[model samples]
Target: MGTVLLAAGVLLWSAAHLFKRLQPAKRAELGDTGRLYATVAIFASILLMVLGYRWADPVWLWPRAGWMIHLNNLLVFVAFYMFAVSGLKTSLARRIRHPQLTGFKAWAVAHLLVAGSVQGVILFGGLLAWAVVSVIVINRANRDWTRPPEAAIWREGVALVAAVFLMLVVGIIHGWVGPWPFGGGA
Candidate 1:
């Protein structure tokens, strides 16, 4: 049942996201209202996926090592930093065309490394494929790309600091929900 819910959630979320890419003309016809509806669907599907994942029985594929945990932690921190960079008006943001997507890919890969269960693979692997496809589609859609204006160094520094703080907060939240990111059992 949990696996079924997870698959349904992934399908729903993917369909909601890909609809725009598949039918830009239709999406444009609906405009902001359509975008809002899609957003709602995506969030709802994600909630379902999370709940399903939590309830699912584990079908482990491999033994997780301490090193894998350390690598996952490092990747997660970098992913958060990339996400922060995406939001800030920084030189890094200007240089990196898809910081958010890159961060998401890293996050998915990190989870995939540690989450050896069948459900975990389905969730993270599915998301990873989605992110990759989204990036490809977006790049193809936008043929000509112009560079953004550069931001101040101070602003970039602040964003980096905020990223570090956010990473710590995320680690704490991870511990609260399940496994502690630092290798300590929750």
Candidate 2:
């Protein structure tokens, strides 16, 4: 049942994201309303996915390695930094048009490395594929890219600080709810 829900949630989320790219004319016709509906579906699907993943029985494919956890932690930190910089008016943002998607890719990959269960593979692998496809679709859609205005270097510093703070908060929550990120005893 949980696997079914997980698959359904992944499909819903992927479909919602791809709808605009697949049917641009239809998406434009709906305008703001379409975006709102898509947003809601994405959030709802995410909720369902999380719940399904938690409830599903674990079927580990391989032994958990300590090094994998360390690597995942590092990649997650980088992902958070990319996410933080994506919204900020920084030079990095101007250079990386899809920092958010890149961050999502990193996040999904990081989790995938550590989680060997069927649910983990479905959830993280689905998201990674989505991010990859999204980047490709977006790049093809926007042929002419206009670079953003230059931002102060200090803005990047601020983004980095914020990223660190976000990482701390998320790590704390992860430790509380699931695995201890630091390889400590669960």
- Model 2 deviation from the true structure expressed as Cα RMSD, one decimal place: 1.4
Q: Write the per-residue lDDT of candidate 2 for residues 1-186, one digit (tens) a residue.
A: 888888888988999999999899999999999999999999989888988898889898776688999999888988988988887868998988888888888899999999988889999998898889888998899888888899999989988998899889999899998888867776
Q: Relative to the unseen true structure, what is the Cα RMSD of model 1?
A: 1.4
RMSD per candidate (Å) reads 1.4, 1.4
Q: How displaced is residue 181 in candidate 1, in Å?
A: 1.6
Model 1 per-residue lDDT tens digits across residues 1-186: 888888778888888999999899999999999989899999989988988898889999988988999899888887888888878867888888988889899999999999999998889999898889998998999978787787888877887798789888988898898888888665
lDDT assessment of candidate 2? 0.89
In candidate 1, stretches whose alpha carbon ends up further than 4 angstroms from where it belongs are none
> Estimated TM-score per prediction?
0.94, 0.93
- Cα lDDT computed for each candidate against the true fold: 0.88, 0.89
Which parts of model 2 have CA positions greater than 4 angstroms off? none
